[model samples]
Target: MLTEAQAWQALDAVEDPEIPVVSVTELGIVREVVAEGDALRVVVTPTYSGCPATELIAESIVDALKAAGAGAVTVETRLSPAWSTDWIADDARAKLRAYGIVPPQSAAPGGGQVVRFMSRTLPCPRCGSTRTTRLSEFGSTACKALYRCEDCREPFEYFKPI
Candidate 1:
């Protein structure tokens, strides 16, 4: 009979399948977790709706909860509120940079307090220089955009904040 907090603590230990360096919680993926009757319901916000990672993430969330002794865990994806880069949280952003990916830079709200991930200039992950250019809006993954480091002369991807 684990409490809701206890269940979350367990789920928090589950790391992201793609970014193993950070857990889904740290990544702010788990938006809500609550116990209903004899079942546990978890809400996860997708980084990108079309991104294939959403499927795997949902599976991992369910498996992790069950492994943590959750009697019946129901992982649900909520798109109504949608996911935003702003929800990445400060801790997750740091973990991303340490994981060799250039995290999105926080900027003033573009229009309606919406953190603009793409409008802001992304620095090169290799050289840490702002003098970077976008080679393409699309990257190796649909969630990322291809970029070139002008200073390092290397190509890296910026995890666009969705």
Candidate 2:
């Protein structure tokens, strides 16, 4: 029988499809894990409800647990109390920076507000310069914004706070 600790350890190896540098657990996606009898249930809250990788993430979670000797695995999607960038682990934030993606600067605004327009200056992950310009509201994904660093002349994505 797989214990909750083992399940969590197995899931810690599951990386985010979009951000491969960090595990799903590090991204704060895997909310809870329960082992009951011969079955295991994993609770996940996606970065956003409309995330394109939601289905894939769920599949990965189930596959991981099953591969870890879980007889039956079920993935539950939890949307209420929606996922927030603030839930991101500090180590994950550093990983994002090292991966050249600008992490969210502060806690996401309350009241279910998503920050689409960045009013504050975002430091460049590569050059560590504050002189940066947002190239577009949408980056490689809907959850990020494209930005260019004036100092390094390199373009990068900023994970939007939600």
Best by TM-score: 2
Backbone N/Cα/C clashes per model: 0, 0
Off by over 4 Å in 1: 107-120
The TM-scores of all predictions, comma-separated, are 0.84, 0.93
> Which lDDT values do the candidates have, in the order given?
0.76, 0.88
Q: Assess candidate 2 and give its lDDT.
A: 0.88
Q: What's the alpha carbon RMSD for model 1?
A: 3.2
Q: How high is the lDDT of residue 132 in model 2?
A: 93
TM-score of structure candidate 2: 0.93
How displaced is residue 65 in candidate 1, in Å? Answer: 1.2
User: How well does candidate 2 score on lDDT at residue 121?
Assistant: 91
- What tens-digit string does per-residue lDDT give for candidate 1 at 21-104? 878887777998989977899988887767777888888888877877778888988876766677776887788887767776
